[model samples]
Target: MRVEPAALEQAASKAGALENELRSVDVALHTTAAVRGLAGWETARRLEQVQSRLQDLVTGLANRLGGVSERLAATARNYRDSDEAVRRRFDDGR
Candidate 1:
């Protein structure tokens, strides 16, 4: 079976974009008025943790998607090469 890289790449891109957006939120939440008291500090800490975990997850997924793209490209090339070989062997009577 053949797998398309475009779908995987799009998903990876969306995940990366979400991670970036979360990172921006993290940065925005790191200030004085945002983390002033106990509740605010706890909220900021939890947000930091969430951002870190999501960043790692999205980065890993993107890396895996990249690998899948490369593998699928190689698979396509190998299939094309094999098809050409068969065609040459049969059509050319060689």
Candidate 2:
């Protein structure tokens, strides 16, 4: 099974980008005060609860993306190391 380290690296880069984007969105959601307008109605309370849940979801997704990126990068490194080891052994045998 041939593993393309470059392809893995590219996927890792994309995952990292998505993680950053999600983090940014989470930050925007948390920092915006417009959602907490001056209203004590039950609907406003429900809206706050929904917003909180959405923020949590975004945070969780970002965390997962970060984990995926890390794993992908590690896999790519491992593949590259294995390839280098094989090449070195082949060269030594020549």
Candidate 3:
């Protein structure tokens, strides 16, 4: 069967319009994807920085707590020794 020229022209115009629309959609999709990828990378970097900061803070707190514990232990030992000396002095007097 032979196709009419008018119908062929109409079909060709429709195909061209569809092709242009597809190209526009593809460009938009690529742009959106690139933006999303960039955002993801930035977010990951920020998270890493936060994690590093938190680790530093935790380490500092741990060091401070260790020093405090050591000081307290020394203070307790000194008090105990002083009490024992006082008790010995009282026993000798009696």
Candidate 4:
């Protein structure tokens, strides 16, 4: 079956329009994907920064706790030593 000249022209025009539409769709998809990728990278970077800050806070807290613990331990030792001395004096008087 032979297509008329007018029918052939119309078909070619439709195909061209469809081709242009497909190209536009592809460009839009690539642009959206790139934006998403950039956003993901930015999010990851921010998260890493937050994690670093949290680690620093944790380290500082741990150091402060260690210092406090050391001070308490020394106080306890001094109290024990003083108590033993008093006990010894009392026992000698008995």
Candidate 5:
């Protein structure tokens, strides 16, 4: 597969933005859960569970994006090295 650092970086940025949005929702959920729990609502626990699952999803996505970005960077560097090696061989008339 072709690798592009800029594209990967952009994706990482988008993931980061989503993470930020999730953070806001997470805070809201915490507040809501607290209020609901105090009122003895059974849904409060479910809301908390939802928040926790969202957190897990976001965390997993962030980790995957990070790994992808690192792999893209490594691929770019490998390609560069290969290109340089080929160029050197060509220039040496090998």
Candidate 6:
């Protein structure tokens, strides 16, 4: 299989950007969840619950994106390292 280090790095960058965007949404959800009024009302309680669930979902997605970014970066590094090794071997044979 052919590995394109640049492509992998670009994908990693995109994943990182997506993770950052998700984190921004997570912050917004946190802020919305912090709103307080009629704490004893059933509707308010439900709204809070929904907000909490949404926040959890967003956080989970962000975490996954971060992992993907890390893995892609690692893969790119590995490919670059191997390429360098191959180049060195070729140079040494001269």
TM-score of each: 0.56, 0.87, 0.53, 0.49, 0.65, 0.81
Estimate, for each residue in 7-64, the C-alpha lDDT of model 2 and write its tens digit.
9999999999999998888543553464456376676676677788888899999999
Cα lDDT, model 3, residue 91: 100
Off by over 4 Å in 2: 26-38
> What is the Cα-based lDDT of residue 53 in candidate 5?
74
Q: How many backbone clashes does candidate 1 have?
A: 0
Candidate 3 structure quality by residue, lDDT tens digits, 26-47: 3333344454565768765665
Show how many residue pairs clash in every candidate, following the order shown. Answer: 0, 0, 0, 0, 0, 0
Candidate 1 residue-wise lDDT, 1-94, digit = tens: 6654555455556655655554455333444344445455678687666666766775666566566556655665666677789999898894
Query: Which stretches of candidate 5 lie above 4 Å from their native place?
Result: 1-38
User: What is the Cα-based TM-score of model 5?
Assistant: 0.65
Q: In model 1, what are the clashing residue pairs, if there are any?
A: none
Score candidate 2 by lDDT. Answer: 0.86
Model 1 residue 66 lDDT score: 61
The residue-by-residue lDDT of candidate 4 on 1-94, one tens digit each, is 4324444444545544544443344323334545456576876566556656665665565555555545555555566677789999999999
Q: What C-alpha lDDT do the candidate models reach, one value each?
A: 0.60, 0.86, 0.55, 0.55, 0.65, 0.87
Model 3 alpha-carbon miss at residue 40, Å: 6.2
Tens-digit lDDT track of model 5 for 1-94: 6766557566656655665554455544445647565566666766666767777876676667566656665666676777789999999995
lDDT of 6 by residue, 33-94 (tens): 44565466777777777878888898999999999999999999999999999999999999
Better of 3 and 6 by lDDT: 6
List the lowest-lDDT window of 10 residues for candidate 6. 26-35
Candidate number with greatest TM-score:
2
